[model samples]
Target: MRLLQTQITPFVNNFLHIDVREQPFLFCPLHGKPSFHAHPELELVFILEGFGKRIIGNQVTYYETGDMVFIGSGVPHIWLSDPAYYKQDSTLRSKVIVTYINPKVFESMFIHIKELDGVKEMINQAAKGINIFGDT
Candidate 1:
């Protein structure tokens, strides 16, 4: 996958390497123009309020409030807000909560635990990106 100009180092150094970083309030406009980016860490994103299109690998999907997605390592993706959100007069805003996870860390802890097989499988699937739905 081609790496985008925006690298994930800041997030990695500031959040992932230390602990699972949970940013409960993320403003969208700060992300600027949507650009495809990839990183070696897995990410979980919850949209509290927003409307946009998400590009993950070959799939392009539209999303709004309450949309939650789990993206895997090295998978190129980005969330592009709707054009209206970029307008100066528009009051619309995008709010999100993001969590970054380093699968390698968990692997070291659970690799020998047979009980965590299901969890391991899920992590493997996340490498291709997973869109969580419903209340569960």
Candidate 2:
């Protein structure tokens, strides 16, 4: 990430969702670029198209289509798309579905509930980020 631009994640009805696509068009905008930002909401990201690098906490790694990751609340992260995706004549486009979970809501609804032990544990585990795979 080139910048630390932490800010309040805008939510639509207590959650934030971002989706983008391209047809036969050329040039794709940077999906979420140039920042290591953190917020109070937990994040889940599923990459449906393109490949690039991601920084979650101190972990800097590469990500491609079909990769799914969950980032805990307050963890700094960013997704930097490949250069070709931003090129004017390139056909490469990045598509991802990103969802943010409000911790206050999650805690009130699931974290402290008696029947949601598994969910509570999972949310706690997500504080360090997770890579979901295979039928999950």
Candidate 3:
């Protein structure tokens, strides 16, 4: 498997890189602002509260509370909140639980365990992006 170098961004380099070597996964709870960006890691996001549009690669779709999405590495994406959420006086809130995972860790498991072939195939499909629904 090929691994791409991680893209450096202010949100990643400054905020997300806290002791990543000790823990390859990053769990973040985000509210309000969203960043339009891409990085070299798989991302799983659960929309706890919000209503907006989600853009992944060239696909655009509307999303709301309880929505979940998985984005591939190097795929540009953003969860843009509804216009009202951007207003200073607006009381609306956008909350999301995001988890960033290093593919190398999974790759290692795939290489060592033959039983993980199914999981490996799933991850391979994720490279092109996958939208899982119904109790994923």
User: Which residue runs of candidate 2 sit more than 4 Å off their true CA positions?
Assistant: 1-10, 15-32
Pairs of residues at least 3 apart in sequence or in different chains that clash in candidate 2: none
Error of 1 at 113 (Å): 2.3
TM-score of model number 1:
0.78
* lDDT scores in order: 0.70, 0.70, 0.63
TM-score of 2: 0.78
Residue 4, model 3: lDDT of 28
Clashing residue pairs found in predicted model 1: none
Order the candidate numbers by TM-score, best to worst. 1, 2, 3
lDDT minimum window of 10 residues, candidate 1: 20-29
Flag the better candidate by lDDT, 1 or 3. Answer: 1
Compute the lDDT of residue 71 as modeled in candidate 1. Answer: 84
TM-score of each: 0.78, 0.78, 0.72
Candidate 3, backbone clash total: 0
List the pairs of residues colliding in candidate 3. Answer: none
Q: lDDT of candidate 1?
A: 0.70
